[model samples]
Target chain A: MEDKVKIIEIKKSVFAANEKTADDLREELKQKGVFLLNVMSSPGSGKTTTLVELINALKDKIKIAVMEADIDSDVDALTVAKKTGVQSIQLHTGGMCHLDAEMTSQGLNGLSNLDDLDLVILENVGNLVCPAEFDTGAVTSLTILSVPEGDDKPLKYPLMYQVCSLVVINKIDVLPYFTFDVAKCKENIKMRNPNAEVIEISALKKEGIDKLADWVLKQVKNWKENK
Target chain B: MHELGIVFHIIKQVEEVANKNSVKEVTKVVLEIGEVSGVVPKYLHDCWKWAVENRSEHMKNCALEVISLKATSYCKDCERMYDTVKSGRICPYCQSKNTYLVTGNEVSIKHIEVKDEN
Candidate 1:
C-alpha cells in the first residue's frame, strides 16, 4: 500500500503578498496628497518628544498630523496633542507588536480630515525587531536612536537600520554624559544601509532641529513636485 | 513582532487555496521560514494551533510544520559564503567587511497536505 496523502505544491510568500497591500496603500496615500512617515524606535527613545518637536518645526511650513501607536496606551498620543496642539490620533495594537500596511490604512481612515493634511506621521510601536519587518505604507520610514540606547544598537538590530530611510540620533544634548560614539554609530548604520541618511538631534534642547526640519521640508517638496 | 497576525495571514491564504482545490480538510501546512525573517516558529505554531481550532472547522486538527532555513552571507572580497549568524557581516576567512546576505530572509509556504477520501 502506498501513502495516500496528497501534497499540493504552493511556493508562495506571505510577506510578499502583504507587501503588495503596502504598495497599494502607498499609491492611495500618494493620490491623497499625503506623505506618510512611519517613525519607529525602542521604548523611551524619545519618539514622542521628537514628534512634538517635529510638529512644531514643520507645522508652520506644512500641514501635519500624527498617529501614535502603542500596545496599550493613549498617553503618548495625549502628550503629543497637548504639547504640539496638532491633530493627533491614538491607535492601540491590541497586543500586536507591529503595524502592517492594512493597519496603517485603517488608522488613516479613522484619522478623518486627511484631505487637509500634507503629512501623516505614524509613530509605530516601540520595538526594534517587528516594526522593521512590516511595511507600514509610509512614504519614508524613520528610526530614532537616543543617546541612552547605545551605539551598538545598529549592530544588534540591523534590520531596523536597513529598513529605515533615515536614522535620527536623538538626545544629542546628553551625548557628553554617555559614552555613545556618534562616528561609530554612523559607521554601523552605513554598514547595514549605505544609502540611509543619519541625522543627530537633541529633541529636548532643540539642537539640530533646523536641519531636520529642512530635510522634512525638502522631502515634502520633492514628493509634491514629483507627484 | 506579532506572530499571531502572521499566522492569521497564513491561515487566510491556506483557506483560499483549500477552497480553490475543494479540500475537505487540511491535514497539515508546511511553511518555509527563513532564519532571519524575524518570525518565531514556536509562536507561529502556537498561534496556528489556537487559530485552526477556533476559526476553521475543516482544519481543527491541522498540524503545522516549519522548515527553518539557514542564514548565509556571501563575502564579496573573499568570494566565499559563511553562516550569517556566526560570521555576521564580516568575512571570517579574509576578515573583510564587504559582505552581503544571500539567503535566509524569506517567509513563505512550501506546500500543504489535504485529506484524501480515495
Candidate 2:
C-alpha cells in the first residue's frame, strides 16, 4: 500500500456519468414518440395494480408496454402480462436498489420497437430513496404512496416527493377505515413539490382510476406538444 | 437510507485530499449538504461516525462539520424570494406554480481544515 502513488484531490461524482446517460436515454425516448413513465415507490404500493388498471383503460387509445424492474422475480412481469395482455419484460438487478439509464436501455433494446408504442412504463425497483437518484429514461416520474405507508412519507422522503411529477395517493377505498389523512398527505407533498400533481385512487377497488389514466394521457399529450 | 453511501463518498474524498496533502492527521472534514437532499444531518453524522471509526491511521482524529444549505423556490408571480427552510416545495412569496428550485440539490465537499502532525 505504501508503494501506491497518490495525487491531488479529485472531485468526481459517483453518479455523474450515469445521470448523463440517463439524460441521453430520455432524449432517445423523446425521439421515438414513446412517453416513458418511471413508477417508483416502496414495495406493495399498488404500482403494478395501478399499472394493470392503466393498461386496461388506455389499451385502445395507445399501445402500451411495461418493463418491471425487480430485485429477483419474474412474478410481477407475469402478472402484468396476464393482466394487460401486453408485452411486459422483467429486469432483475440482482440486489441493486436502483436502476440507471444504462440498465433501462437494455430493456428498451429488448422491446419490439420504440416507435411502435405510445407508452412504456418502467416499474422501477421499489424504494423511495435510491431510485429517486437514478433516472431510467422516463419522461415522467410517478410515485405511488399507499394509505398504509402513512402521510408523513412525503416529509420523510423529500427527494422522491420533490422529483415526482405525479403523486398517486392510493388505497382510497380504505381511506374511510384507515387513519391516512389524504389532505395532509397532499399538503406534505406540496410542501416538497409545489408543482406536483396529485390524484387519489384505489388500485385494488379500481376507484378513481379514470382520472389517473387521464392525467397520464394528458402528460403524454403535453410532452408531445411541448417537445 | 443513502447516508452510508454518502459517507463512503465523503471518506473517499477525504482520503484523496489527505494523500495529496501528505499530512498525517486530518483535523476536520467540512461538508456542504444542501437542504432537500433527503439526507438527515443526524443520520449522516451517525453514519460518518461508524464509517470513519473503521478507517485506519490518520482518519481517527478527523472531526465532521456539516454545513446545511437551505434551498427555496422563488415565485415569479410576485417577484419575491423568501427564505425557505430545508425541504419546502412551495414559494412563500406568491405561491406561484411557475417557481423553480434555486439551490437546494447539493452534496459537495466545499472545503476542509487540516493540520500536519510534523
Candidate 3:
C-alpha cells in the first residue's frame, strides 16, 4: 500500500493575519473617534517619564487613557496612574517580547471608558527590535532615543526608525556629558526615512514638553478631522 | 522570545487553514525565510517543535521545512547589486550609502503537506 499525501499552496506573509487585524482595529478606533498612539523605546530611555509629562500637560484638555505593556510587574501602570491621575491598565505579554494586534485589542478591551477617551497611549515593551515589527493599530508611532544611547542607533536599527513617524530624542539636558551628535543623528535618520519628524526633549526637567504636547494635540485633531 | 510568538502565529494560521479544508491532521509545513529577516532558523525550529505539540490542535508533531533566500541590496548610485550580508547598507562597489534592499527580509508560508485517507 502507498501513502497518500496532499499538498496545499498557501503563499502568504507571516504578518498577513496580524496586518489585517491591525487594519480592522484601526477602522474600529476611527469610527469611535479615538486616536491610539504607540510609543517604542529601549529600557531606561525615560518613556515613562515622557509619558507622565505629556499626559499631565494634555489630561485637562482631553480625555486620555494609558496602557502599559511589560513582560512582568505593573510598575509603569501604577506610575502613570499616580502621576497623571488617568485611567491606566497593565498588559502582560506572557513572556512574549512584543505585543501584536490581537494583544492590543485585548488591552483596549480592558479600558473602562474607551469610547469616551480622545486618546489612548500604549507604552509598548521596552525593546526596540521586536515591538517595531508588530503594529498595534496605532494612529501614530513614536520612537524615543536618549542622548546617551548614541546617535548611530538609527544606522543599527533601521526598521525601528523607518516604521516610526516621529522620533523623540530624550535626555537632551545630558548632551554635554555624552558625545551624541544631533545633526549627525538627524542625517542618519534621514538616510533611512526621509520624512520622519524629530523632536528633542528632556522629560525629567520638563524641557520641550510643551512642544511634544502640541504635537500630540495636532495628531489627535488631524486623526479626527482628516481621517 | 519573538520566535515563540511567531510560532504561535503560524500555528494559529495553519489551524484556520486546516479547519477550512477540514483537515484532520497536518504533517508538514514549508516556510520561506530570508537570510536577513532577523529570524534565526535554529530558534524558529526549536519553537516550532515545542509549539506544534503544545499549542496547536491539528498540527501536533508537524515537521517544519525552511528555505533560505539570499539577501541582496541594490545600489542607486552605481546601478549594481551587492550581497547584503557582506556589505550592509553601504554599497561595496561604489562606496555609496544610497542603497536599498532588493530582496530578503521575507517570512512567508509557501505550502503544507497533509495526510489523505483516500
Q: Score the docking of each candidate (DockQ).
A: 0.56, 0.17, 0.58
Of candidates 2 and 1, the better by DockQ = 1
Which lDDT tens digits does candidate 3 get at residues B11-107? 8888999999999889999999988777778899977888998899999968999999899999999999999888777789887878888888888
Docking class of 1: medium
Highest DockQ against the true fold, candidate:
3
Better of 1 and 3 by lDDT: 3
Question: Which CAPRI quality tier does the interface of model 3 achieve?
Answer: medium
TM-score of 2: 0.77
Candidate 2 ranges with C-alpha deviation above 4 Å: A1-14, B1-32, B40-83, B91-100, B109-118
| Residue-level lDDT tens digits of model 2 in B7-58 | 6657766776677788676667766666766667788888677778785355
| Local accuracy of candidate 2 as per-residue lDDT tens digits, A93-207 | 8667778788899989989866899999899988999899776768879899999889999888888987788999999887777788888898898877877999999888899
Candidate achieving higher DockQ, 2 or 3 = 3
Question: What TM-score is obtained for chain B in each of the predicted models?
Answer: 0.87, 0.78, 0.93
TM-score of every model versus the real structure? 0.90, 0.77, 0.90
Pairs of colliding residues, candidate 2:
A191-B89
How would the candidate models be sorted by lDDT, starting from the highest? 3, 1, 2
